[model samples]
Target: MNLQAVLAINAIGIGIIVFVLSLLRRQRLHIGYGALWIGASVLGMLVVSAPPVFRLVTRVIPTSLPFQAVVVMALSFIFIVLIYFSVQLSALLRRVTDIAQHIGISELEAKSQAPERNPVEVEKRGE
Candidate 1:
């Protein structure tokens, strides 16, 4: 990789790290999400700082170019993150369903315990 490209990558990695840290400080991002961003930024920085390591990775992979290897790695990372978020969403959905069912059951129980009121009697009392 060229010096300019390496510097640009480092700059981007540092920017991401700073942005993640600010979000964490402001409590805008949860720790689990922040950690993933931080890890990605660190990995980017490491790869940018060590061109030889990237070259080695490209050699190990079937990619003809370093850029292709990087792209593949990025896509793989995104896929894994997507799977993680999907699992989290599924759990949240399950919990919400359980809560709604519980509320429905509680409402039924409460209604059964309360005495039924006659509309005619209620209207006469109001008059």
Candidate 2:
């Protein structure tokens, strides 16, 4: 790649890193996810700016076209993020289920322990 192209990629990568840090600072993003973005940006920068690493990646992910490596890399990153989100969602679902069960049990127990009123007297008052 040309120097200009490399510089542009580096600038974009740096911009992404800065944006992710800003999100982290604002509490809009979790540290774990922010780290992922930063890592991706760094990897992208390295792949573009470093020929050796780029060659290695291309060799490992061989494609019919030269630019396919970038496409494959983007797809792989998306797949990883999807898997991470699915795992997080699964864990959260389990936690929510457990919490709901506990709440239901607590409510049941409280109701059982509370004093009971006579249905007949309650109806008479209503009348």
Candidate 3:
């Protein structure tokens, strides 16, 4: 790799690592996701620092270019992560809906059991 490309890649990899660490420190990111981000950044750094790895990958994959292979790998990783998050979101939505239904049912049950009181009787009793 050229000096400029190496420098840029190192910068980006370091930046990603730093950003993920900060998010972890702030409790803004989950540990699982943060670890994945860190791993990706480290992988990027390794790929950029050593061009031979990319060459090996290209040879194995029969890709036209090393960059294309890298792009495909990155995209594939992103797609998998998106699918994982989608499933998690679906589960959370289902739980929330169940909780809401349970709350509604509880309110209805409570109302059914409680005797209705007349406002006029209450007022007269108060007076």
Runs in model 2 deviating more than 4 A are 113-127
Model 1: runs farther than 4 Å from truth? 113-127
Candidate 3 stretches greater than 4 Å from native: 113-127
For this target, which candidate reaches the highest lDDT against the unseen true structure?
Answer: 2
Task: Quantify all predictions' global Cα lDDT against the true fold.
Answer: 0.84, 0.88, 0.84
lDDT of 2: 0.88
Please, what are the lDDT tens digits per residue for candidate 2 over residues 1-127? 5788779879998999999999999999999999999999999999978898888888989997645886799799989999989999999999999999999989978888755568799798995
TM-score: model 1 vs. ground truth: 0.79
Backbone clashes in model 2: 0
Deviation in Å, model 2, residue 29 alpha carbon: 1.4
lDDT comparison, 2 vs 3, better candidate = 2
Residue 69's lDDT within candidate 3 is: 72
TM-scores for every candidate against the unseen true structure = 0.79, 0.79, 0.76
